[model samples]
Target: MLLERGVTDAELQAEANRIAVKVESIFSSYLAGSGDGRDRLFEAMRHAGLGGGKRLRPLLTVATGRLFGIAEDRVIRAGAAIEAIHVYSLIHDDLPCMDDDDLRRGKPTVHRAFDESTAVLAGDCFHDLAFEIIADTATHEDPFVRAELVLEMARASGPNGMAGGQMLDLVAEGQVLDMGSITRLQQLKTGALIEFAVEAACIMGRLPPEARTPYRGFARDIGLAFQIADDLLDHAGDEAVAGKRLRKDAHAGKATFVSLLGEDRARQQCSILIGQAIEHLEHHGEEADLLRAVARYVEERDR
Candidate 1:
């Protein structure tokens, strides 16, 4: 299969690294303070929010915004807000009541580093901060744009999206799930925020809803592909490189794409999805090189 090419792995990593720095800086600024009784909460927030990861969601936001000629600074702020939500989700996901994870990004999980209550509060604060950043005039001057961003973020993170998918995931433990059920579970748990990342750019660009069909297609495809790749990683990827535990799904008797389809078929499916995702960008030109690179990266990343 011939893939569209412009950006190299080094270039993509460089760009991701740059975005990571900027987003972490934003978290630092938002989290900076002292002399309060809530200092531990702030420290926990900083620990989780500032910890480095792929930062893929924010990268998508910025890359999509670039397609619309949006200002980089403005888009970066919006991306930072989305990443804040992502970090918040990770914090909660790692809690004892949730995934019960001990390590994240190769370091102690927030609950382990601090305490369970502090981790919970830090996650809550980050959730609130996500909306605070989005609703602030700094993200966008237009009230309507800010409002739309808030609405989408809420839906993506609320009961209908990530949280709902998580519920489904928990329920599926030790139960048999068909392909459709597993797909839907991942779409909500993983895809919703990814879709929001792209849609946010459309909102900022003021693109009409009707014209966003292709971008939506692109987001949906890559989102599923990303999750499949994650499942593959869990099935066979190196835990040291992944910076966390793997095979927990299998251990818990949860059905995943890799578990259902097996390794070869699952990898093929990811390739097909990445190809379809890039096809959605057919109308775009060189300016979309980063987005194309991202789609391929989603399929090829080790962690």
Candidate 2:
């Protein structure tokens, strides 16, 4: 019933894109006034963090916050913080030591466009900046809320989460990973931050922990589905549209859901997960329509 609401995918995308632009401006201004003319570092940071990608994580933050009627500006600030970490991860993920990617979001990888050292520094800067942004008083009126946001983000990005998953991924290369291991790897590498994106809204809204369970479910399922879709894209997706290289996992002999389960089975599983993800939003009513649409879009996207 709520799906019948007039909100369109285009509208959601527009809002998300708008947030992306705004965050880029905010981050750029911060960098400009930060210190001496260390212009190259700032340029590298801007290159990686600005003007690209789908901005899905930030959109999730904004969408979830909307469900609680949180201030749009506050949500945008949180989204910006989340996105800084995300972009930082991407910069590192594309490094020669990591994925060795030469292209990302249809442009040269930071390492490829700049230098390896500069790329590393840029990622490190963005990582630190994410925490600084979230901890700032401007992000929330309540100091406790800001502190909690910082703690949660640290947990999401640190050893128990993204970093741990990346370690597992590095290990999996040239080794066989069971489905369980693969699932765990993806849950940490991809799902943890996504979980934070949605859950942070609850913190920002001052919602009880109980209120996050459904959204958490939604994030977990969709996060996996999103990765599965990504696997499919890598399996046969066009590099031009994806704005990155494809089939690298196979080349590296890495394990992915698509590799473990065939295309047909992966598609089926992704659809099933999307169904589960959408069900989690029923309690949110029409306010979550955009999130529901996003779950479907994740599976259907070409890139």
The lDDT leader among the candidates is 1
Candidate 1 stretches with Cα past 4 Å from truth are none
RMSD of each: 1.2, 1.6
Angstrom error of the Cα, residue 101, model 1: value is 0.7
lDDT of 2: 0.86
Give per-residue CA lDDT, model 1, range 132-188, as digits (tens): 888887654589889888999999989899889889988887799999999999999
Give TM-scores for every candidate, taking all chains together and pairing residue i with residue i.
0.98, 0.95
lDDT (Cα, tens digit) per residue for candidate 2, span 211-275: 78888999999999999999999997998899999999999889899989999999999999998
Give the Cα lDDT of each candidate.
Answer: 0.90, 0.86
Best TM-score among the predictions, by candidate number: 1
In model 1, what are the clashing residue pairs, if there are any?
Answer: none
User: Once model 2 is optimally superposed onto the true structure by TM-score, how far is the C-alpha of residue 162 displaced, in angstroms?
Assistant: 0.4
Lowest-lDDT window of 10 residues in candidate 1? Answer: 1-10
Q: Residue 191 error for model 2, in Å?
A: 0.7
